[model samples]
Target: MSNDQPLKGQIIIFTGTPKSEDVFELVEQLGGTPISLPLIQVSEWIEPTDEQRLMTCPTYDWLIFTSQSAVESFGLKMKRFGVSPDAITSQIAAIGTRTAAALTKIGLTVQFIPTVFSADVFVQEFKPTENETRRLLFLRGSIAGVTIREELPFDVDEWTVYSTEKAVHNIESLKNLVQTEKSSTLLFASPSAVNVFSEEIAPFTGWDTYKIGAIGHVTEQALIEKGAHVDVIPSTYTLKDLVLELIK
Candidate 1:
């Protein structure tokens, strides 16, 4: 234990396939030895059928993009089909601030951004009153879960821009780490990540020493339901806040 470290040699477990190493570096800066036990993995991909459908669509009244990956995946398919990104006239609806940045990077302006990031919040807060044609197109992942299930009314053309693959490396690493002293803190960003952790990481019973910290209610609820011992959660959803709370 160092006398100058804020985390004071705390062991931490990161549970999820991180998009980049920025978070890891930040963890190190906070004086925590992060255990790389990402529980769930996400890959960028699109279905052939969905790509074809999108290429064939005449036009859309609105285009909904929920994640950065959605924008990238769709961009790939559009490039493969020789479609111009500028040709799409439908105003883009971004789910979050990061997603809005992604759309802007591709030279598209966001016409709608809901108060919240979830699809349910997006649907409730979005007002289609300006346009008479209630048509929309959703660009999202294959395993986006049911976030958008009841969000749209009747039917909206959903373009499968990407598919989520369960990354097995996190669990494999977790199992190996569990063999040693469990001093790391398991951080779960989502409920799915928690489920995968509970199923993949061998049961600890009374021998486990890792503290679980879930980012949200959904994730916290999932962990408790699966009998995991959760330690902390911040009022905000950002990773920076989560880590900062742990530091405090």
Candidate 2:
């Protein structure tokens, strides 16, 4: 292998979708083959009342976003309802850098971000201005936990803007890949994706047979709980950071 191609002959599989072109390009740049074996799919899931609530989102004191999918779904809702970014008077808080970037891409300014990306860290670190009736709205996915809503000491409302489901259709593709690539590395970005892979794929292709990479602690914990040994976890929770760790 050439000195520039540190990851030559390595096959890195990403178990989430829609696939990120940036991640794929990064892996290829390092002389690694990037594969997208999507185990979870996300889509917008808006209700009739959600439209009304989103239209009046400016009334809230703070808007919390935990994932990029939530931010994308929120942007879609704003476009659909004709809600202009200039009309938003509420301060925005994102869980991590990627979520913050997604919000900023839609012309919304983020006022706060936790030192850590996890919700548990966010709850402990984020402190809104003290008010008698501070209202916080969390734009979340259907499978998200209640940490933000239950832990925050404010009147927090949640809008399930997106839903995630197992991408079972890709199971055969995963099996095929596992059969062919004995030394491939599997990277998981979310606990949901880990759960899906653990349930459907792990039984067929033993968990310990491949090197595993988790984007964050939550996903690492999920893999550990499922009897899978995680090989790499980046200090920073991002795809680029995770890929860098893998090459190192």
Number of colliding residue pairs in each model: 2, 0
The C-alpha local distance difference test score for the whole of candidate 2 amounts to 0.88
In model 1, the worst 10-residue window by lDDT is 200-209
**Per the 3 Å backbone cut-off, how many clashing residue pairs does candidate 2 have?**
0
C-alpha RMSD for every candidate? 2.9, 1.4
Instruction: Give the per-residue lDDT of model 2 (tens digit) for 28-145.
Output: 9999999998899999997888678887798888999999999899989899988888988899999989889888899899999998888989999888669723788989899999
lDDT, candidate 1, residue 82?
A: 77
Q: Per-residue error at 211 for model 1, in Å?
A: 2.2
lDDT of 1 by residue, 6-28 (tens): 76567777776555577777788
C-alpha TM-scores of all predictions: 0.83, 0.96
CA lDDT of each candidate? 0.70, 0.88
